[model samples]
Target: MPLSVVDLYRDVLPRTNCKDCGFPTCLAFASMVVSEKLPLKNCPHIDPETAARCQKELDAQHAAGKWTRRDMAEDALQWAREKAASMALTDLPERIGGRLHGDGPDRELHLPYFSEFIRIGAGGIRKENGEPLNRWEQVFVYNHMAQGGRTNPTGNWKAFQEIPNTVSKVKSMRAHVEAPLAERFGGKAETLGRAAMRLGGRDLTNESRAADAVWRFTPLPRVPVMLLFWDRADEFDAKVTLLFDETVTDHLDIESILFLSERLTQLLCEDGTG
Candidate 1:
């Protein structure tokens, strides 16, 4: 099918996230294949029939020049635009956990982000002050369009590892997110709390368990991130556990979750908050 990547990898792939294919995960490989980033022969595990079919499909895709990173990113952006524009202005606030303003075409979808309300609409997003966002922050806008949430955070949170499809990405998540978080504020309990609070996160130390510091943040409306830190000790390794609302996948894919976590870590460290 056109929606698939050559159709051979789905059933034949080992799904092992082995980087033998030059991609971190098999899913990433599939996306790259669909984007024509790698040829099918790189996997080395596919049978001759599958390999040949993959080559044929790859050729077809390349001939059309339809599957490139730039092409796909543009497509995703266009999709976000269309989806946001097509959504019913009135129902958006309730459906996606954002606040709506105005009526008809003048309506704007506003979501709480860090310390501000990001205003989004068919014309694209801007800050409450009408300033534009960099490409990095635009992911939040795209996610807001794609999210299909209808409920609120249930207050129950779990680590990213608890989420489906994130099992294979745990190591990378740690390296990019948890590790940095721990490095910066693992033993500095006060700094951790201060940085989190700077991000508009609420300190929930009194309500949480076994945590040196715990802060809750609604980074993107329905999407909440819980920063839970266990201070380093002689008996225990220092750790930073980022937990998400149990229903996070209902609003975003696992990749988006990873993106948010990694970006949050980077922001905290780079902004000198961590």
Candidate 2:
């Protein structure tokens, strides 16, 4: 069967936009691989065996037949939209910790995300500043779709593996989210604070006082993420620990968690701190 861009990517790609692979993003690199524009050896992170396996799969598929998986992104978004449109907006606050706005036909669900509120309407969504949120709407939609029971951020922080059923993702999550974050801003320790502030993160160190620098960010309601940064030392290299509320999966799927983590890394690196 023909492999999709994401399928081939999931096997060998780190899914981080580290740029060592020459393409700007691993996604783009995967595309280039699919198009025969770049070889797997260009990416250093992929082990020799994984690259060889991917190459064999590519060759076999190319010589025989190709298959495509169902378009998960579009289908999931449509399903989420339908689900949100059918539900009563009045129950949003209790279910997912978002307040309802307006009344009757004008009613919409308002959920806090960083410094902005993602407004969900029947048609789609908009940013707090009233800009069309084509990309962000999917997250809000998925948040609503996966949202079940409500839970608090427990103040206690844990790694992805510490969460249930997420142990398999520890290596990829560290490669894609944790290690890249440390590599990006671990040197410019001072500027990361401003970048975190841009994402509505506040220094929560005074409350817990465990990390050298601790910041709390709520990318979505009920999805509180804690980022702990430790500067490099003579004995220890720089480090970053990204923690999540245990109840995170209650509001977003594992894919969304990865997406949000990658997004945070992108935001941190955007200030050219790397």
Candidate 3:
């Protein structure tokens, strides 16, 4: 038989008045534990033995309820359909005029240039020469692209121009677009890097410059994804790179990506996929 919350508490929670889990009482923590909202590790009072036992129990529950990659893919496809219906687009377009032409490609069609960098503890953003960026600085350099709400100044300005637009849209409607998905599941949106679309009337195969924009997403916490986007010098072809955090890569199978992609694509397309 499985251990009930009562059994776990009676055998585990130290009945003391220790306000460790931010709860006024151990019983309150117990409630949270039963709901699986608070892990036993938060108690601070549990010894290693008890913590291990609780962890084992929770792990079992997670293994049983966890979703697979196929499940995510199905959910993502459904989400995409709904998004397409709302966006008034029967099928996603390739490009619109000089800009990207897709309705909600970011949700499903992985863009070419996306990447991730883990910032553990405090660190300064610096230029290539090791000069630290100012405290008021709005942009940080990552993979030859500038991130945050600032304009690029170098000759590479075209590489990061579209970021502001995407950030603005995401920020304006994050709750309406992202909250519901997160509530139903668990993940976060993050800005990983930037990219550029080919610009000018010249044939892309001969163009040297491209239009650029930032990349962002809601990812599972601690399970980061790497994205890479680049076009050939002629701008005729594009490429995408996806790097999964080794720690959680096994958890991020194709299905989860599909599900997340669908949800995001739907939200971005129709104005509300939350």
Candidate 4:
């Protein structure tokens, strides 16, 4: 006889429900499990041993090209995590503040700055419009820069100018945010670049080169947009040109740059103030 939902729940579920599986009860999940509509792995509290057993069984069903409840659960969890990670920081008060401040006046804006080189056509041609250049490029780039802080003379504007050392700061921020999030998503830092490339419909082939390509992506949910900057050095003159990925304009309105600047200023203040 085939296993009933009750039997599956008794044997497979942690019996805690806990909503960790995103279902109301273990019985509900069990029903889905028996129907091959959900995966037992979705139950976060289930012991690893039991999960392994359930997975093994599910894998066998899958090997025969049959859909199992386990696959559905896995797919649901993946969708949830992806949605969470893609959530815009603008929705979080800690990240973007509660209210939108109008673009009124004076403030300091900090942007991302980095150095790198752009290799064209793989020939290593170093001349652009008849000028000698180096492989290193320097750029002052910002993901989001808008009006921030008071109009006081001692505001972020003054500090912003002094903080060209944004590279170390950005690196620190990326280190703090990327690792744990990547682990949760079953991915690594490289996954972000791959996703960006896919979204941009461009191929990034030369990532292993000596030049450390600094890419910054900031998503503003309030404005419903994404901002990206690619900094690299010219092979001939060695000048750095901050290139805005054209794809960004397609997704985000350029007018949002004002708010972006403000949000970035807030970020700088928080990072420095602490």
Give the runs in model 1 whose Cα sits over 4 Å from its true position.
1-76, 82-85, 235-237
Q: Which RMSD values do the candidates have, in order?
A: 9.2, 10.5, 19.7, 19.7
State every prediction's TM-score relative to the real structure: 0.67, 0.68, 0.28, 0.22
Backbone clashes in model 1, listed as residue pairs:
none
- lDDT by residue (tens digit), candidate 1, 1-274: 3435545456757788779888888887877777755776788677888778757866776676765556544565566566556666577778776688877777888877786788877567788898876554566467666675687789788888888788889998999999988888767888776677677889889987648888888778788888888889997778988999998888877766887787788767765553
**Model 1: residue 3 alpha-carbon error in angstroms:** 31
Model 4 spans with C-alpha error above 4 angstroms? 1-4, 62-274
What C-alpha lDDT do the candidate models reach, one value each?
0.75, 0.74, 0.36, 0.36
Alpha carbon lDDT at 94, candidate 3: 27
Candidate 2 per-residue C-alpha lDDT over 1-274 given as tens digits, one digit per residue, 9 for 90 to 100: 4556888678668887899988899888888776663577788999999887777777676555354234566776677666556556677678777788887777777888777788766646777776766553475455554464567667677777788877677787889888987877766777888888878998987787777789899877777899988877787878888998877877777766776787777767785443
Report the lDDT tens digits of candidate 3 across residue range 1-274.
Answer: 3555676568788978589689898877776676553678888878988788777876675556522113443354344334333331222122110122234532222112112122211133333344543321212111111111122122212111133333433433334433333332221121112111110011222243322212323232322333233433463433332233333212233333333334333433333222
| Number of colliding residue pairs in each model | 0, 3, 18, 29
